[model samples]
Target: MDKIIIDTAQFQRTISRISHQIIEKHASFDDVVLVGIKRRGAEIAEMLQKRIFELANINLPLMALDITFYRDDLNQANADPIYAGVDNPIPIENKKVILIDDVLFTGRTIRAALDALLDRGRASKIELVIFIDRGHRELPIRADYVGKNIPTSRSETIQVRTEHYDGINQVALLQ
Candidate 1:
């Protein structure tokens, strides 16, 4: 069975709320970089970037971080070794990076993203922003900013559909 947890209106409100939270925490976005995980994460980052710009009138640097090797579904034995995504080579030395993602399940993806970030440059600090926190973390990682918390069982899955990918904006729970 599949159920819609969040609709389009809620999605817009969530992004606005999250944008306000980020602005509240930072007096200045000069050294702050918004790095979204590829695909959905990247799309959310763009949304936040636009929202922040509209609210604060200052544009923050945005980048998409692709963790092909970090994902369990794509990192199989017979998987392709090539990373097809474009490489974003922005120097993040001593900068505060706000890592964005769609969901927080196993912390392995975050760990792999950390590795990729370090390879780019030594960040002063890294804060996480997850659109959904669905529990069941395999590691100690946690999101600093969460749009929503939907506790899920191991047999279930949380899918966040966006206009960029699924032509809709909503959160769906599938079992």
Candidate 2:
């Protein structure tokens, strides 16, 4: 796969800024839950949780969600099949949920995530936080907090690596 480099330093700064923004908007992490989509999204959520605690001195609940089976394109030939599992139980009934993901591509993943989350319980509100927001959304979903926006073709992909998962932190353009 062809690779293009994205500045790691800049990405960290963006994440820090987003964390601060989240804290500011909510004013407190009292009723906030951070739910990360499986794989890279989970890693980002962990980081966000840490940042939130560091910034606000509040320990927010963190959960991981797998929306692979709920994907609309699951039956497609190119859809990479993932063994779905719910690692963390969502216990935020009537609390605000901040869904975290590494990248927002087609927006279908977010839709599936919502379905899975609702199966567990209803949240007071659901906010989206994505590391990368690429255009060409096929669904009406939008992120509440985004680290970066990179416009690219549908054939391309954005790969995010964090120290929690890959032992490094970076974002790359892949083809």
Which predicted model would earn the best TM-score? 1
lDDT of 2 by residue, 78-164 (tens): 856867687767687899999999899888889999998998799999999999998899988899999989998998888887877
Q: 127 in model 2: Cα distance from truth in Å?
A: 0.5
Q: Would you list the C-alpha lDDT of every candidate in the order shown?
A: 0.90, 0.86
In model 1, which runs have C-alpha deviations exceeding 4 angstroms? Answer: 71-82, 86-88
lDDT of candidate 1 over 49-128, digit per residue (tens): 99999999979888998888766667465856667563455679999999999999988889988988888899999999
Please identify model 2 stretches exceeding 4 Å from their true place.
Answer: 1-5, 77-84
- Give me the candidate number with maximum lDDT: 1
lDDT of 2: 0.86
Clashing pairs in 1: none
Clashes of each: 0, 0
Q: For candidate 2, report its TM-score.
A: 0.90
